[model samples]
Each structure stands twice: as structure tokens, then as C-alpha cells.
Target: MLSADRMRAHLDNARRHLDTARSHTGRVATATGTAAATTGLFTTAVMGESLLATLAATGLGLLVLPTHKARQPEPEKVIERTADGGMLVYTPPAPPSHQGRTAAVLYATPGVGLVGVLIAEWIVPGFHWGEALAVALWSAGTWLLRPARRARHMLVPPLPPVEKVHDLVVQDEPQLYAHPAAQWWAERVAIEGGAAPATVLEDVEKTGESAMRAIIRASIPGEPVPDISVRRLSALMDVPQDLITVGPVPGRGASVQLLTVGQADAAALDPARLWAERIAPLAMPGATITAINLGSMNLSKEDA
Candidate 1:
């Protein structure tokens, strides 16, 4: 029912999962086997093959057994081929942000409760192997659950609502406008350019290699501000005046067209490749409005 390529993909994924589980199980087996053997030596010397020593020897034997195996199961996802020869991958529902924290709390609870019991046992002059086992179990549970919570978050990353126009430009960290430069030209232009109290909306259709455009509808207490100057934006953005441009949008009286342009080398790459690499990943699918942060672009090669 499946193509050869699809079958091969599934098999490859399964093999990778098995390899990871095998690696974890191997480490666990070695550690547990070594601990059990050490316990056997100590107890046999003290009590001479007592019940506790016998149990340690049995656990060591189990760890060395050829038939013993351990494998961790991963969360499931659905993948299907669309009619248009496209791949549609579906991730499971996102886990809560506090999932890892909750797991840590739960795992710590038993250890907290056993603190008094452990103190009482330590008051006696004997080494309590059961207390040691309990502590190790709690530590292992906490450690193992951390990776599981992280994997769940990776499978379904959270997508918060776009609160403002600036959020579209900087998806990862919208709060911080720019890196070292602090080029928050939009806020500056709206205030100093006589366009204070402006409503900015991205012009998704007009965005391309040349410029990233937005419509600014500005107003004062009494009347609407019709236009904002390119020079003002240029000064605010801290870029060359030629890189920034402004125009009037049709049928929008109080709105001014704010166009942000990139460096000269932007048009060197093919449009399709450029869109795929730079633009497509930033735009959300089925989004009605999109933000493009092309103007006054930050180059990695720029000296510090």
C-alpha cells in the first residue's frame, strides 16, 4: 500500500529510534550492573551471603542476561501526502509550558517525604541500601522526565497571537526591536515625524526584493496627519536616506506608504530561492496580514 521510498523512510526512522533507546539502555545496564556487583562484594564480606546479598547478586545476573532489553517510546505524529504532491506533516497538540516544572515537582515530592525517614535511618549505625535505592530512583525519574518534556515541546512549538505590527517583523523576540544597534525606527518615526498615535498595518502584497511596505494612518487630537517624510524615517532608522522611501496609498487619505529597502546585493539571488529561504519561513501560512523587516537590513559581515 506504500511506495518504496515511503517504506524506506519509515524504516530509517524506526532504526534511529531503536539506536537511541539502545544507547540509553546500555548505559543504564552498565551502571546498575556495576552498582549491584559492588553491593554484592560489600554485603558478602559483612554478612556472608545473607538475603540482601542474594538479592544484589540476582539483580546483577539480570543485568548481564542476554535476553534483557529496554526501549523508550516516543510521541506519535501523522504524515500524509497531499493530492498536489506535497507533504503534510501534523504534530501532536502542544504540551503545557509548565510541563517540565510540574514533572520536577512531582519527582521531588517523594524525596522530600523520605527526608525524615532517611534521617531516622542514618541515626542507626548501619548502611541502609534500601534508602540508597530510593534516592537513586528519585534522581533517575527526575533526569529521565526532563528529556521527555523537552521532546514534547519540540514536537509542537507554541504559536502565540501577533499582538502588534512590530511582532510580525521580529517573530522570535518581538520585544527587542534590534540587536546591538537598537534601530527602533518605527516608534521614533511615529512620534517625531508628526505621525504620533499612528495605526500601522503591513502591506503584504507590495512586499518584495525592493522594499518592505507598511501603511501608517496617523492622527492628532483634532485632525488626521496626511503624510510622513522619508528623511524623518531615514534619520530615525539610522540608515542612508536613499534606502528609505515614502508614498501615498490609494484611497487611504490619512495613511502614508512607508517603504523599507535592503542593500544593493539583495537582488543578486534568484527571486524564488530568495523567497524560499528568507521570506517563506517568516510568513505564517493562511495569515491575512504579514510583516516584512527588510529595510535597513543588518549584515553579519558588518564590523562590530
Candidate 2:
């Protein structure tokens, strides 16, 4: 029977073998694609072997090219001397950093295509400057296609109005100026644990027969924004003075408008009730009536 350590070692070795096999497969696919795309780049008929070698090298080079990986702080290690002159290693365990907001991105080297070109020049016989150029072209193509981290756009369809909404005079009703831009750090955070992969918010346009003009585009900032700031914004939903908007008031109705640009990341704030809570304060004081679905407000110009 194998010990647990031996079993674990076997598993690790298997994983490494699988990884190498996968790497080889990807290189083959990449080389094939390059051959197809670069057929026009070089005179294949004149330099068959050299061109094939160039393409192969270029494809394989891309996967191996080194790029910057997100660096993490190494665990602090302490060495203690024992009574028998033996040294014991101790690693101070610490809680993982609350990186809920930090976004993760897979960065690629832009010039690696050129690296592939150089590699092909060295390995393939009869390789010429033209073939080198093809390698560079293939490298650039691979670099562009490599998947990496990106910002997350948080905008869901305009959510239903917040709870406890009461009809208020249209003139007295204040327009909810867009929340000051927040740097949705979630976009840059690693795209794992069900987190979003991108950010997509835009200006809220004028909709419906109402007279309200476009006030402003509400979006989180590009920089990592603190949750405290967003939480404060949510809290202010109850403050009448903080309410800001523009344009003449439209006809009054029993329904409350929860405006949203319908972007992808819009739902991110739903768990925190950022929109509904904000609308609650602007309703008639002490009046707990607000319309959840006041018919659809067409966001498109053709609906007008």
C-alpha cells in the first residue's frame, strides 16, 4: 500500500504530465493556425521547409514566452534552533487579504511575437528575414488572442423601485443624480469565486413621456473604490437634501421610477440595495406606497 505522501506525489506527477501534454497540443494548434494565416505572408512554394520551421517555432515560442505574473507576498518564515542543534521551520499563518475588490488580469508580453521570429531564424534551415517577419506576425497574433483579466461592468436592468415608495408630487420629487463614480474594484479582482469578468456602465438616457432630461451618467470609478464609499451612498438614500436632479417635473403618478442603464455589472449592488434604498427617501414622507412595475420605460428612441 502506498503512503499518503506517495499518493500525493503520484497525483502531482500525473498533473505535470497532463500539463505538458496540453502544452504540446496548444503549440500544435497554434502552429497550424499560423500556417494557415501566414500562407500569404511568405512565399511558401520557394521556402517550404524553412517556412514550416519558422511557423512551428513561432507558435511554440508564444506559449513559453515569459510574462509578468501577479506577484503575491511570500509567507513569512522563521527558523528556530532546537536543543539538539536542529532547526525547525515555522511559517506565521495570517488571514488572507480581503481582496474582494481587487481585479485580476492575465497580462501577456506584446513583443513575444518578435521573440518567435528570432527563434525560428535560429532553428529552421534557410530561414530568411522574410520568414522572421512571419514569425513576428504570428507572435503578435497570439499575443492579441491570449485571454487575460479585464474590468467588470456592473449594470443590471433598471431594478424595481425600492420598498416603501409613496406617490409624491412630480415637482417635489427629486431626480436621483447618478451616484458619484465609484472605482468598482471588483473589475480588477481575480475573476474567480463567481465574480464578474468585466465592467459596462453608461449614461442614463431620458426615457418615457416624462420631461426629465439627461442628468448624468452614473458609473463606478476606474480605480479601486472602497465599499465604505458605496455603503455611504446607499445610506444617503434616506436623506432628502442629498437628492439631486435636473429638468422640469413631469406628471405625477403612483409609480416610482428606478432608473438603470441596464449594464452587466448593474446587479452587483443589488445585494446591498444601493438603488432601492436611495429611492425610498424621495417618496412622500410617511407614505409607504410606491409602484414596483409602472409599465416599461422604453430605453430606445424608436419607442417614442
Alpha-carbon RMSD of each model? 26.4, 28.4
- CA lDDT, every prediction? 0.46, 0.39
- Residues 134-159, candidate 2, lDDT per residue (tens digit)? 86566566545642212111111122
Model 1 gets an lDDT of: 0.46
Maximum-lDDT candidate: 1
Q: Which regions of candidate 1 fall more than 4 Å away from where they truly are? A: 45-227, 230-252, 256-304
**TM of each candidate vs. truth:** 0.24, 0.21
Candidate 2 structure, TM-score to reference: 0.21
Q: Record all residue pairs in model 1 with backbone atoms less than 3 Å apart, i.e. clashing.
A: none
lDDT of 1 by residue, 1-304 (tens): 9999999878776766654674475446435433543443334342333334434533553343322122223446879999999999997764443544443444234324334333434454456676566546644653455332233233333333326776566545433333222224334444443433344334332345444544444534335544556565566566678876565544344434434454434443445544554345445333332345556856686653
User: Which 10-residue window in model 1 sums to the lowest lDDT?
Assistant: 64-73
What are the runs in model 2 whose C-alpha is more than 4 Å off? 42-71, 74-107, 110-132, 136-304
